[model samples]
Structures are given as structure tokens and as C-alpha cells.
Target: MSFSVEEGEFFGILGPNGAGKTTTLEIIEGLRQADAGTVEVLGMSPWPRNPKLLPRIGVQLQASSFFERLTAREQIRTFASLYGIPAKKADDMLTVVGMEDKAGTPAEKLSGGQAQRLSIACALVHDPDVLFLDEPSASLDPQARRNLWDLLRSLNEAGRTVVLTTHHLDEAEALCDRVAIMDHGKILELGPPATLVRGLDSATHISLATGTLSLPAAREVAGPDASVTDDGVTVTIATRAPAPVLTALADRNLLTGIQVRGATLEDVFLHLTGREYRA
Candidate 1:
């Protein structure tokens, strides 16, 4: 739980439900207190609501609420007022989140994705240096999620430090510069996704179409410790060398449509935590 997030870096915390991911983030954001362990956010203690620090960080909780009857622009204006931000600043944020056209739409009328984006826009209206996003896209559709990702990338590219928690492995792989895998209130792994995946002893995977071959023959082709799925065609070889298997299949002219690919973050997570990234 003790780590530092550098400026302009997209850092991710990943874990399953009730794994303390949200608790850890809340503690860091000063929304909740930790019984033990010291936390310094942006070099300032989060407790006691440090006035200097509060204005420097923006937070988007998993779920945020506003006056249900207020329009998006009105909600933005209300939040901006809390930070003493100008009205024009709120308008700019609305434009930034693609809610400009829907500025007049009431909070209760917005689609789930639009509301989430508006919440993010409100958080960013004050022009904070750091952003905390907790499951920002958890309930969003695929297209909406992609849109949020692009917006986040733009924000990071403009030098905003973002700390994100998500269950989506692919999202983390695509957006995070580095990630810490947490479970049971402790870090199980921490590194760039590619480096962590490459560090696994099981580095190669061979997938074949199901019903395209025999399990016994495929297992014979693959050595012991190789895992063959019940479907009988997808075999994973946990070895540094995959060329030999490829060569063997080629020699026997049995390689047909076989694919060799590097391990993914999901593979590394499964190996380390014994849990699947279902989301």
C-alpha cells in the first residue's frame, strides 16, 4: 500500500471485489482513515483536509450524486463554486467532457455513461494536478468506455497524474503505464503489464481451434506440465522455448492454423493470484 505515483503517469490498482482497492484509494484521497500505515498524497498528509492539498487533487468516486433536477451545467457550476472556480471554467469543463451539447440536460435525465462523464468533468473543473478515478468505466458500455479512455489519455498527455482502480484487465493493459495488483489489502505484484507478463515462467501459449485435433496427439507434441484444455485443442506450454514445438508440428505437417503468442496480463494475474480477471 506504500508507493508513489509520479507526475503525468497513469497508475492503476487492480483487484477483485472486496480486495481493499476502493478502501486504499479512499484512504489516499482522505475520504476514509486507515487504522495503520502512513499515507502521503502529493507529498502532503491527507488527514485533516489539507487546504493546500485539496485544491491540487480532483476525485471521481465510483458513484457521485448531485441535485437530480439540476442540469449538467448547473451541477458543474455548483461543484466549481465549492472550489471558488469561475463560471467560465465550469463551461470549459463541460465542453471538455463532450457534454456541451447536453449542458441543459438534467442530472436524472442523462444516460449512465453521460452522467459518469459529467461527474468526471465536475471533478476536473478546478484544474487539479492529480485525478483519482475509481472504477470510472465499471458500468459503462464499450463505446462510452473507449471515449473515456481517449479523454483520460489526453489529460495525461497534458501532464495530469491519474490514479485509477479498475477490474478491467484489458483497460489497464491499454491505459496504465504501470500497475499494482492488490489483494487482501496487500500488493501481490507491481510493474508494467508487459514486463510482468514477460517475467512469468510460462511465457508462451499455443491456441488451436477446438475439434481440430486430438488431445493425446497434441499432448504428445507438447511436453509434460503443458496444460490442455478440456476442449482438447487449446494447449499452453509453459516454457522459454516455443520454437521446438512449432518445428515439431511443422515437421509433422500438423501445425495447421496453430498460433504462438506471448503471455498476457490475465495469464500473469491468474498465475500469481489464482484468480481470473472476469471483468
Candidate 2:
């Protein structure tokens, strides 16, 4: 519940449904008041809805609501105008989010991914010092998600602080300089993704195409301690001692399509939060 983000750092907050991720973001963004704690952004209080703070931070919520009957271009221009930004700056933001081609298209007619891009463009139109994104890629397709990732990276590299809340562990791992993993409205872990993952006493997973090696053969090479599973399409072996298993597989010429994966942020998340569905 108590943590600090360094200036210009890409910090991520991760949690399942009802875990207070959005509530935390709202409080930090001056949209909601905290019950009993001090909060500061840019060395100023946010709870009173400081007008000065509004111009320094940009927020893109999970559900974006654009002005009625506005095109992509007009929507962002309106947002820019509110901050006293010029129309040319708004147009540049559209291009920044790759929405220039859809600029003239009505917001209602844009696809979900395109709409997300527009929302991001609107948030960035003012060129705020900090940006807040709540599940920005929640419903985006793979390509759109990757594209958004690139855009976010570029923004951070340009010296803008980004505070993101997402359920996608991979996105956090790939984008954040540090992350906070929360559950039951409390932060359970906080650290760099690699450091958190390395602290886990978890097994490495080795996988291959199903037909490449028989399950029985893989199990034999993997040994009794290692767990092996074949789910038709892929055969996976989980082992604490992967070196010996890999050496055995190499000796037997059974390494085709082999993929070795170390512990990842997802593993760290599941270990801290437990394996259960969240509403």
C-alpha cells in the first residue's frame, strides 16, 4: 500500500479483479480521495483536485468516453484546447498514436483497438510530464498490443513518467522498470521483474512439439523428480535440474523444437496471489 515511484520511471501496478488496482490509480490521479494516508505527485497533494496538477498529468482510464459526435481528430483537439494547447499539437498526438489515418473517422465508428489508440492520443495531447494508463491494452488484439507497447516505451524513453495498471504480467515484465504486485488490497511484492522472478524457487519449463518426442521418452530423460505433461499439441517438462535433463535429451537426439523457459513474472504473480479465479 506504501511505495514510491522514482521520477521518469515506468512503474506498473498489477493485480486481479477487485484487488484495488484501479482504486489506487484513481487516488493517485486526484480522481478519488484516500481514507488515511498522505499522497503526493510532483510534490503536491492530489486529493483536493489541484488545478495545477491537472495540467502536469494525463490519464487514460479503462473505459474511455469521448465527446458526443466527435471524430478522432476532433476528440483530441477538444482535449488539447482544454489545456490551452494548439490544434497542431493535437494533430501530432494523433500521428503519435498511429491514428492519423483514422483522424477524420468518428469516434463511434473506430474499432476497439483504434479507440484505445485515440484515447491514448487524447491523454498525451497536452504533453503532460506523467501519464496514467489503466489496462490500456485490455481488449486489444496481439498486434495492437505490441504496437501500444512500442508507443509506451518511446514515451518513457523521452523522459515521461508512466504509471500503468494492468492484469497482463508479460506487459508489466516487458515495460516496467519496477512493479508492485497487489492482492486483497495489499502489495505482496515489489521489485524489478527479473529480481522477483529470480527469488522464486520454481521449476524451469522445457517444451517441444508433441510429435517430436514421445511423452514416455521425455519423462525417462527428465527423471522421476521432474514432472512431464503432453497436452497433444505440446509436450512440456518441468524440472528443478534442467541441465541434466537437457543434456540427456541432447544425447538422445530428442531436442527438436525444444524450448527452455525460465521462471517469469507470471510465475511470481501466481505464487504470491495463489491459483484461483478472481471476480
Give RMSD (Å) of candidate 1 vs. truth: 2.8
Listed in order, each prediction's TM-score against the native is 0.87, 0.96
Best by the lDDT measure: 2
lDDT against true structure, model 2: 0.92
Error of 2 at 257 (Å): 1.1
What TM-score does candidate 2 reach? 0.96
- Stretches of candidate 1 off by over 4 Å are 223-225, 230-240, 249-259, 276-279
Best by TM-score: 2
lDDT, model 1, position 236: 48
* Number of clashing pairs per prediction, in order: 0, 0
